[model samples]
Target: MNSAVTTLWEEAGFPEQTVIQRAVSDPLLAGQSVVGIAPTGSGKTLAYGIPVLTRLVPNLGPQLLIIVPAQELAIQIRDVLTPLAHRLNLGVLGLIGSANRQRQIDRLKGKPAVIVATLGRLADLIDERKLRLVDIKTVIVDEFDSFETEDITTIRHMRQDGLLAGANLGLFSATRNDDDIAAFREFWPDLQVFDEIKTDDTRGPVTHYLLDRQFEGKVQFLERLGREKHQRVFVFFNHKHIMQKVAGSLRFTHVPYSLLATDGRQVQRAEALGDFRRGRTNLLLTTDVAARGLDVADVTAVVNFELPNNITTYIHRTGRTGRMGESGTVYNMGNDHDLRDLRHLLGDSVTLVAEKPLVKKREQDDETNDENTPSTDSHDRARTRPASDKMPARKPTAAKSHNKRKQRWRNKKNVGKHW
Candidate 1:
């Protein structure tokens, strides 16, 4: 690492390199095409950023091109890399679909050293001959796991057309599967891949809980959670309609929250994110795509209003918290059947416990006794119960006690609702 960059890193309060940083720094700085996989909030950006910045020359016309899946992430990477780039007298620019194209092209006239962009907008500019990649020495594909099929196709076209022909490639993500590698190899066959390090020490300790919301509906539970003493909470929903409904309910109830939706206007989305980051909002309601790879500081808990369909989504959602070795909590809210399915999906990887209601002492001996005190939101009392992998034995409910034949008939009668 450069002495000045190291000094800047230390001045920013990062005493030492993170695990991912230590693993990828040398390979990246050597100008090798590398693929790095680590847990979310593992400082993957700096794992590549520091090295890329160290080698970049000032006054270069877009030497570094970082492709991301979403516009928000593009903006975020630009924000994170700007200060460091300026330290070396380099400039950074963001190319996103939501912003003005002419304005972006106007800014491109300044010859920025780094370009953090989404695939769609960058591809459009390249196709229109408004952007040049001649000076690009390194191209980074960040959060490749969340990219769609069209994104892959665009990347292939870029490489085939010689836009990124000679640039060294770096692929980084928190999750990976067979398909991801197969797709990468199909395009960049010579790239060296690094297997995910199981013993990742960067992710902090996270306590998982299955909070029962049978009596209290999921939205009601979120409302109550916002009223508690929690700092920053991320509430995820699988369905957009459900998330919007919850957001409306939170607003009606005066619970502070910010919504991050794919269809929101750029300025509005930026404002919402800024409000959340500044602690003006207690809760951020979003889906998986909108929140992926977003790093916010001091997030206390992650609440799943509706459990995700797969374990990969679960990992990314919970990853918003417990980042960079910070203690955090994850609450999976659902009814008995929902939680049972969630437990089955998670298997033994994550331990889930049923949160029990703890009594809150009142300043005066008031006549009203509210038993639904949320102790887990409190910093001091969040860890009142020991971590346990075993779930408590299920007590049969009246709905489950019914005969299977009748339930099958009822489900068939209400097939539309089930679907």
Candidate 2:
């Protein structure tokens, strides 16, 4: 590590390195092309930020180019690294979609050491000749899995056009599957992959629960849970309409809440996120747009009003809580179909909880009846029915018997295989 950069890093109060930082810091600083996979809030920004900052030379025109999927994430990365860059007498510019293009061009005149930009804005600026990548030494792509093919193509074109010639590339994200890795490797054949992600076991101290309920029932359940728990909460939905409906339901129930979604105005989104972060509102209703990059501490619970389509979305949604070893809980509300999908994705990692009181009462009554009845008599009664009973029984077929025997033998053979 560079001595000046080390002093600035320590001064920034990050004395201890996270697992990702420790793993990739050396390789990244050594100018190696690395692809890092780690959980959200694992200090990935700093892990790559340190390498970029350490290698930066002042007044050298943009030496680092950081591309993100969303403008919000671009601003976030700029906010995190700007102070550190300023400490070293370096400039950092954020080029996002919702900002003034001419103003950004004016800032580019100074030639900041680092430029954080969204994929679309960066491409536009590069095409207009407003931004040049000739001096770039490193190109960091954050949240690479969420990027579209066109975005990836832009990066490939940069390299092909010699704009980013000899620049080391680093891709970082919390979600990277086999297909994502394979797709990335097709573009950069020599990219080194490093994965430290343990989504199942390393989610800090989060407890996951599946609630059996439909859409309306989930809204009621969420209202009840919100009234009962006095902690910060985030309720996620898959669509903007669903998020709006949930927000209306919360408002009707007199629950203090705020909305954050992609459809909302930028100012409203900023104010809503700020209000939730500052504890002005305890509940935040949002969609997957707020799933990956938004980081808010003190969130003790996450509620999935609608279950995500895949395990990766589920991981990022629940990752809003239980951050940095603090204990948190995630409640997933779903019906039978949703439950089946959740089970297939999470396996036995999630606990099922009955959402309605009637269901719980009925289950308790069944348990009581089982305890009070005689086992032998109950079995005989179940097998033999009276003439008054309308239902009829038929004898089992030879094929059924043979299949039962085969299943029994297979079970016996694989008694402890799964355990």
Give TM per candidate: 0.83, 0.80
Q: Among all windows of ten consecutive residues in candidate 2, which has the lowest summed lDDT? A: 351-360
Please report how far candidate 2 places residue 248 from its true position, in Å. Answer: 1.6
The per-prediction CA RMSD against the true structure, in angstroms, equals: 13.7, 14.9
Q: For residues 209-316, could you state the per-residue lDDT of candidate 1 as single tens digits?
A: 887785347777777777777579998888899888777777766688899988899999999999989988889999888887898888989999899989889988
lDDT of 2 by residue, 1-419 (tens): 67865786696678877777777888878888888888877788888997678788889899999988876678788988998898877899999877889999999999799999988788899999988899898889998888777767778888888998878888988877666656656656778888887532335677777788877888887777666645788888888878877877777667778787765666887788788888877888887766457777778889888888887788778877887878888888887888778888876645555444323577788888899976666547866867577365689999999999999998787654410
Candidate 1 vs. true structure, TM-score: 0.83
User: In candidate 2, which residue ranges exceed 4 Å CA deviation?
Assistant: 199-203, 228-230, 348-419
Q: Residue pairs in steric clash, candidate 2? A: none
Candidates' C-alpha lDDT: 0.82, 0.80
Candidate 1's clash total is 0
